[model samples]
Target: MMISETLNCGAIVTTSQKGKGDLIPRAKGAAKLLRIPYVERKRLSLANLQANHKNKDILIFSQKGPQLFTGEGKAHEFHLSMAQLRLIAYDRGETDHLVEALGPEAISSFLDCTAGLGSDSLVVAYAKRSCKKMVALEGNPLLAYITNYGLRHFVHENDTVTAALRRIQVCAVRFETFLQRAKDDSFDVVYFDPMFEVPVTESPQFLSLRGHLVESGFTEAILREAKRVAKERVIVKERPFSSIFQTMEPDELLGGKYSRVAYGVYKVKG
Candidate 1:
């Protein structure tokens, strides 16, 4: 969803603290970036929600980290389930298709053009322990905030996983804008996981993420820029039968027959 749409519906950014004056300044700063009003409350309570913004939807900056409440009692928070899945697959000695397509060991620097909740980005970062740098660009401020918070704070039983999560640098910026300024071969690989053009009932995670998303579907311009910025390869993830894949015509395709997800790859030419 667009930021304007979110603000128009009545939203305020604040801290969950009961009376933390120090948090107010930071909350206000983030509020400015999100273009939402800033309000300070001693405690983030149901009564406070009913009183302050008149029960408007809330974006809270707290000790636990960033979160968005739809006001319908549904809370949107970042989770590292995908990253953890990758670790499990690795333990079983099975390779994720995205890693198979990217040629894992060759990836030292990676760029994720559409970060969303940063699941895919975290997956690759965790898989390639030799990776030196991993940057994920998220266009939506709310998602970026929540994802960044998760990356920094989420703890795993494995220290390596914790280190991998910390290695990612999440930035709130549009993919096209980032690509325009990115130098040639700026990263060893670039990745995109655009929202599907057609709805898939199987995708409950995306369905639950309705209004919380920015609508930047796959586009030729994005792919072109990604190719220019990536040194070795660019990968796009989408449903295999999606029309976008027909036009995308990736140089290499990965994912099993029973798998619903597909990867479209483009290798940079010499």
Candidate 2:
């Protein structure tokens, strides 16, 4: 698809260019798992799609709101925003702790590899003045549009908290392909916050637009590419009780009422 300018900042991206690096993966058995018709062919955004397409009856939910299902059990509920998570991550000198643990020099040029709604990337941009030249890469086109829209408009105007989002460059591309394009030791820190844990009891406002895309599924390849991209260390966020990262332990513990920030510092002399 071609690019068009929105009222906001840089040109709004909506179309998907079929390429080797494109993230148009057929979500495995999305029909069986998500209980919705899975359109095998990848689409950048369903909003722009022509009316009367396949599975038009089963409308997906919009992802603008804070509601997301975290589990399949009775206790499943919505989680907080990246802003709240960052507050907890920075609380009690943990930002400083993450900086020190990941190495200040290593974090100068950062990349959020699994940039699922571009939330965590915004946090890093706002947390410090030194985090320069940052990119939040999301494979999902609709979420990428949301991320791009919020950065250029809503977030930058209200308060300094969200104002930092504009500083981040939005990349609508697949992670592994980006790694191939990027030079070795290109970024100081590559962060990952994979979609793991239980599905939350989602809200109706959420169910309408976020329908098909929600089942993108967990990606291990993202973690592997994150390790390859970071020159210094890779910091990954995971569920508190049942950790997901199979390799390392968090040298530092950044906690919140619900979630936790677990970081691994891999020293690379670049």
Candidate 3:
């Protein structure tokens, strides 16, 4: 079978010549998963790649960690402690819209269909420690690999936070495909936080992620599958008055003042 130009166009996996032996295998595996070539070299100059291959990107493995870089001179890597600040705020009595949307009760399991950066998933894992099984699926392999690495390696001062982060299981697969094979009522709650239809262009953080972000949005078919796999309810996070909400009316809505995120919860019918 011929590989599409798109597969090889933007990215090739590479490892630092001085990269640890243990980390080298992961770099090769990343290349294989993305169906891109793995190049082992002494060093990678992102600036040179930007000038040389206009469309090409690089995922470099080093002793520090795996990082994805676009020729645009920006790098996207997973921060293991990304959710720590959020959790801390919650601990200090901040009302987390996502946690509130899930209700106060402890759920046994969670399935995050669109685990962009795995931020929300980490928060859910921390909040619902009683519900220890948290699985996140990312359609973008690069994002998934980075998140998986962070989850395993990120250390935290708080034992509970560290444990929660470690417990999350991230898989590189399309949510639709994963939902199809999931048994009925496999998880207590299914969550979706797809990329906003209106991108946050003003935010440098989100803008940096633009290159690696998956552009797909949710559809009725996906919602249907999510409902089937969720034993409790399926929750969606989006901005207010999103067109998607009109198409798929949720049974409940949860939001807060000055909050950009809102939730649409569709309870599973017994």
Q: How far off is residue 212 in model 2, in Å?
A: 3.6
lDDT of 1 by residue, 14-103 (tens): 777563756678788778767778876656574466466676667776666677765543466777755677779877989689889887
Which stretch of 10 consecutive residues in model 3 shows the poorest summed lDDT?
1-10
Between prediction 1 and prediction 3, the one with superior TM-score is: 3
lDDT of 3 by residue, 143-232 (tens): 677778888888888889888888888877778778999999899999998888765455454565675666667999988888889988
Per-model TM-score versus the true fold: 0.85, 0.57, 0.88
* Leading candidate by lDDT: 3
Backbone clashes in model 3: 1
Kindly list the per-residue Cα lDDT of model 2 for residues 1-270, writing each as its tens digit. Answer: 211122222111212223123222222222233333334324543333323243242222223321222112121112225465555567556644344445544257888766655566766776655777788776644455445555665543336655566677777665666776777778878776655464343434234334334233334555556666777767765555434544444444454455344454444443
The global Cα lDDT (0 to 1) of model 1 is: 0.76
Alpha-carbon lDDT, every model: 0.76, 0.49, 0.77
lDDT of 3: 0.77
Report clashes for each candidate as comma-separated counts.
2, 17, 1
lDDT of 2: 0.49
